[model samples]
Target: MSQQEHQAHSLKQHWRDIFQQGLQHSQSRYHAEDFEIEMAFYGDLITHYQSQRALALAEVQKKLPQPLVKLWQRANLANYYTRSAATTQIPLLPIYRPQQKASLKHQLWWRSLRFKDEIYKDLMIRLNRHPQLHLKVLQHFLTESYLYLCNDHFMQAVHQRLQQRFAHSSEPAIVVAHSLGTVIAYNFLRANPQFAVQRLITLASPLPYQAMKKSFKQRVARPTSLLGDWYNFCADEDFFATQPLDRAPFNFQPQIINQTIHTFVDKPHEIIGYLQHPQVIRAITLE
Candidate 1:
């Protein structure tokens, strides 16, 4: 094979391995100590998804129709960071007590100094044991009965961080959310009117209220009007994303700049294409 062909082959193989490793780690046994490692693995998977998605979205723009291409350019990659709190926590994960919290706080200061030991301690002592428990706990935690608790915790953290960075911002901030993260974003915006996040790009959001809530029939619905520009995209085969966003009880309306629903029949395309669309790129570009 020519050098170019060989390089392409190598790149494909590398991505395949990276995705496989990410899947393995995410599906691996869950235990207390493994939380940090598991989170790290998940982050790696998201990073891979984000980069490959950007590349794929770029390609889709070339092949698809103008209306369809508009969808890819508007999508935003959601980045996640986890922290602990005294009052709130994920339902399944055991809350670290005051002592553990104190210990962890001290370790945070030492983290840059003794990174290796800290990682090893978390991996060996905690991570190796939690995979099974995680499966059971996450199931319950994710359910409606308990989901609000989890969302609340996540929103508090996101807001706290956002405040620290842009507490007195004049312009609206662009907020991108993925999967369960969308719920957190919604709750955060609802909690604070002063926290004006302008544009919202939601990808593969599984929140049942998302798509369906926009109708006038729903008495109770997600408050979509809070954000200025809203764009929601979902893959055809992503069952979770397919959940009916248009329901009843609470009615909702969206301030949509552009929208598209993709059905990549043959295979999943790159997510970045959503961002490449002229409108979306223009909206997000720093310059």
Candidate 2:
């Protein structure tokens, strides 16, 4: 193999080893049931690492000069919104535009104040203590969010995937999207109003957050393409889904059926936990 190809292969092996080691460490920390969940989460990342890594690296290379700046913008847009006007003493804007003049220290302080919940606290601790492992996990989520929101190339790819998936099919399909997938699914259905989606099941969705709502370029409303109800299931402990999609911006015709659930797992944001919920199962399986 060429030097560049060989180097890329070696780097992939290195990350595989790191993720495996992290998985072993997680196994020791959790009980049997929870370990299964952790294993699946990390294992999927490991198994699909090559493809995901390629996609992420391609997007990063294209935006090499300003990738970090883009990440900061996406992070603020995704996490810096208030739940409601009543909850915070300070008036938080629905939209977040980074203050280019703000000092790094000021920005860090601002983020800390906004993200005071236990989930963010726990994640911050993990980020500090186990930077490699935890940062990898955070990177996976953030990369997907950043690319889809900021990169036109990535958006075109998403549209292509949707078209390819449903090109020949005329029947309305049920969509069950988890985490960042929920954001993509919502945008796709909204942008293409002819997709004929029967129902949208958003698990651990971030749609309720003003941060997510404001990030959308289009008007944030229910997808006119949806012919059935929109069932949103959020775990009580899932940091991304602290609120349900029943408020002003999200509230519209064919109202969203928001259900808050509790997934008593070590990682509440994991898709497996959300998928395994009895209510979610029924929502996906029921006619």
Candidate 3:
């Protein structure tokens, strides 16, 4: 790697190490076995995500808007990161079983051998029978959330995962969540309204998609419950960003600050591309 590249990687690794050290220090009272496992899990998570964020950074800089690239660099210099997946705040909702079961027309929405249904059935079949074949890159959160919706047992792990991403801090956090992470952040905030947040920034968020919104209505907290500003950002061609907060469902809380950017990058959906914008940086780190 080039010297510059090596230095950048070293810096990110430094941050990861510091975070791990803090985690270790804070949890020092845990028994040796549990502490070892926690350390291993957090270590792996930071390494995996640091690599992902680095790739995203390179991609963003390659074609980021001329006006925004410098700001992006400044943000990076300050170690600001756009959260890829996250969630929040009432003492989180009690872990209890909901009375309703999966209410699809048929328990198993499949025709005997014909596979006659349209998108929903075809989608489920693919998800159930050929998930390995699909290998979608950004659908892990959806897959896990859906599993929790169907079997109550998965909720514990899902809740823990969401909680772990909260990133405890003294500074006010305006979570800049992108794509699938938007949904997770929304759910987290709604479910944990007692959890404190100063602001919420969602980019290329798919929360507006009707089917997705409907599917999770019962499972998460409503937007109205959150106690912060919700800034929704998206580009016109970002198909995943189906919903804008202003057009949110009636049940959605007061409202959100929604804006759009015209990205010069080929991949408008890239989280870093969205995050590099000056507005996005200010939203996450400044206020």
Candidate 4:
């Protein structure tokens, strides 16, 4: 590889190490801390992540509009992120059992079938055989609010932290988000349009289009123009994001850039398997 590519790869590995270390530290501290201490720790993490986010954003803004950049830096937006709401636990609903058991032949056939092959076999066949399953899957896609609030808070905290780190830049900011973090990035930019977020990169986001259904349309119908130059990378086999992007419930057009990361031979989502794939590392470091 060229020197630049090697450096980029090194940077990606470094970030992965940092992320892993953060996760380890968090778990250890979480177990040792009292409720108050735990809260304090979370506060610190929020601050740190936000700062990193802001720096990254400012780097992106050099290529964007000034008015938009100003919106990203407003104090009101930061306050929105710092404010806390009451914490309440929402219980997971029980899964319904089918009254009739699968026939031995049917069960055996399904047991032998490959899940990936089945996933793309035929939408109609999958829908017909497991109608309720499909509906429930879609329902799960729509039920993001439980995590949305927390994500929103995270984005604000990141912005505050970023603002301090990248304070010198006058250009519009860029937001790079991965997985569930995409939702947080979206809300942050949407709520702070003045901040001039020039680009948004969403890696493995599960934004359900179905959330915009008649029953829930009102919640997200407002015109919020935060989604610009949005690049959405999805591993075709990353079942986690398949439905969300395809089923999102809004009229907003996202400038989605698709990436296909090859899955492991037999086991996908396993940590080692995920690690072996360069895309996971590449996504974060963008080498």
140-197, model 4: which lDDT tens digit per residue? Answer: 2222322233244543554565445335446654455554455545554555545665
Worst 10 residues of 4 by lDDT: 32-41
Could you tally the backbone clashes for each prediction?
36, 0, 10, 19
Tell me, by TM-score, which candidate is best.
2
Give one digit per residue, the lDDT tens place, for model 1 in 88-191: 21121111113344477566754443443333234322312454332222222223212233334433443565455555456667665555555545555655
lDDT of 1: 0.37
Candidate that scores best on lDDT: 2
Tell me each candidate's TM-score.
0.38, 0.54, 0.47, 0.40
Better of 1 and 3 by TM-score: 3
Q: CA RMSD for every model?
A: 23.6, 15.7, 20.3, 18.9
Q: What is the lDDT of residue 6 in candidate 4?
A: 24
Off by over 4 Å in 4: 1-169, 209-228, 244-248, 258-260, 263-287
Off by over 4 Å in 1: 1-137, 140-155, 209-227, 254-258, 263-287
Which segments of model 2 are wrong by more than 4 Å? 1-141, 213-215
Against the true structure, candidate 2 reaches a TM-score of 0.54
- In angstroms, the error of model 2 at 251 is 1.0
- Looking at model 4, residue 276 earns an lDDT score of 30
Which candidate order results from sorting by lDDT in descending order? 2, 3, 4, 1
